[model samples]
Target: MAVSRGCLCCVKYLMFVFNLIFWLGGCGLFGVGVWLSFTQSQFSSLPLSFPSLSAANLLLVAGGVTMVTGFLGCLGALKEQRCLLMTFFVILLLLFLTEVTLILILSIYHKELDEKAKDDLIKGMKDYNKNTDLKNSWDNMQKIFKCCGVSNHTDWHNSTGTGQLPSSCCRPGTDPCHRWEEPCYEKAKNFLLSNITSVLVFGVCLGIVQILALAFSMLMYCQILRAEKYMD
Candidate 1:
């Protein structure tokens, strides 16, 4: 009987630590993506602020809050008091819910933005061809679009994307395919529509991972206390 009770107590402390580790891990991964988005948009040479910039900042804020809350939960777990544990748990849960909601809403508008991005690219090339007059000499004619590193047969696929696409690229005769590429383009339109579905999947999986971790961390601490009690 004594051994069984000690084992149960140990398990609870371990659970507390586990919960914090998973929560931090998950948030850290998302944080890098969010930071990258901001840097890519604001610091890049062609960096023009887009409507999507708002969304990126929003994610950053939410992720930060969630991470902090998770950490607090971990601390509370160590204290092993019911009130501290419950408070941290509630705060962490609310933060998670907020993040999931934003991820859903932003996904909706992302599709339309992607289409616009594609057209902008095509129009930019056409305008540049018409605007620039490099003497039209045989030498100039030979390197026309290629003057700006654009080949007549420039392949967007596998090409390094440093091109700035004007909105006019979306006009008729311009190819927008270069802007939104591959499976990402196909899925971007429907990503928001599938937000609810993604939430259900990610939420359940992440929630379980977080819960189990905390449960284990706490279980460990509980054991520590129990063993100490026994020695006493």
Candidate 2:
């Protein structure tokens, strides 16, 4: 009933290496989360509807969970403990399910999500002159994207004035600040959709890794249990 020495050694080492990589990735994510939270603290003044705040918070939670799962996986493999291995397996299963569910939800709600995002951006725009933090965030976004407002330069008319636009909306060297013609929302959407393939690929690869980890943990767990019973 005992696991063969070669098989056990191979699985143990593979699990260790995989979890080590996972742990380091978690560390990188956590660092990025901290950096985002600090740099974008200005976004805090905006309503919870703003996506920037949510993104930072999501990264923080995801990073912490990843670090914990990686630690459990590594420890379970090294120690060859059934309890730890089972726990690792359960956590990986849950993560895999959550990822799959999220992908499905996003795919189904794409349009709704788009509308919600636009609405939130518009609401944020209404406070442009009143909230410095929100104004700065929007300025940075528009300037970097070379975009005007949510839909077009005219989208700012209600907030600013009939004829005026924020300086960020304009291309350089215009005496009257000719505003960029593109909309921020469309630019951002296109940017995301253009990169969607890479995102999906990463998610698929991560899911595969989770599956392998789940299988390895369960196989090792059973082997350990058998070994224990044999010893008894």
Candidate 3:
């Protein structure tokens, strides 16, 4: 009986630590989402249609849900509350299933998604001057991603009537950098594709953690029920 009690205590504390980390991760996601939204709003006057806005919104929603569930899990584990633990388990299970489905869909339709993303990037470039937000976003993408037009630097020749490329296409430390020599579309596409594996790994790790948390919660719930029955 003493060993069983000790084991239960260990599980309870482990769950508490896990939930705490989960809560902190959720908060971080929420902060990033809010920052993205605020940044986008700064260019409200521009007719920019950010494709990433939906992703930011999703991060916000997912973060909020994770935070709430984390809190419940922590509290229920500490207090040995069957109801709260069960509730946490159910929510975690649902989230895990949703994430799995998302991963599967993304993996299956990655080619389609990649083409759509490329098209959107090209469209944004075409309208870069039409909207301040789009211009800023494109400039940032080019500079940060070290990319230029959708296909190549020549892609910009058709878009800009002045036959001048944005300074972002120029290499650093060069006063008159040859923008025509630098092509961004292929680089950008490669960069994005390279990160797909990392993203999938991250998702799989998170799903595994969720499963462990769900299992721990169920175990604690059952223990609570057994203890109550023994006492009666």
Residue-level lDDT tens digits of model 1 in 1-232: 5875657556555655566665575585467547646443321221122233343455466557657666766676666655566666566666656766766765787666555654443344343434433112211212221222122224222132435432222233546523222232233223323433543475566667666654554455455566667778
Better of 1 and 3 by lDDT: 3
Off by over 4 Å in 1: 1-8, 30-34, 41-52, 106-207, 211-232
lDDT per model, in order? 0.47, 0.74, 0.69
Candidate 3: the clashing residue pairs are: 148-184
- Candidate 2 on 180-205: residue-level lDDT in tens? 88898787556545634553565456
Quantify how close model 3 is to the true structure by its C-alpha RMSD in Å. Answer: 4.7
Is candidate 2 or 3 superior in lDDT?
2
Q: Which ten residues in a row have the lowest lDDT in candidate 2?
A: 42-51
107-174: candidate 3 lDDT, tens digit per residue: 79967775776566566567767877777766766676676676787767776655878888887777
My TM-score estimates for the predictions, one after another, are: 0.44, 0.81, 0.70
Arrange candidates by TM-score, descending: 2, 3, 1
Measured with C-alpha atoms, the lDDT of residue 23 in candidate 3 is: 76
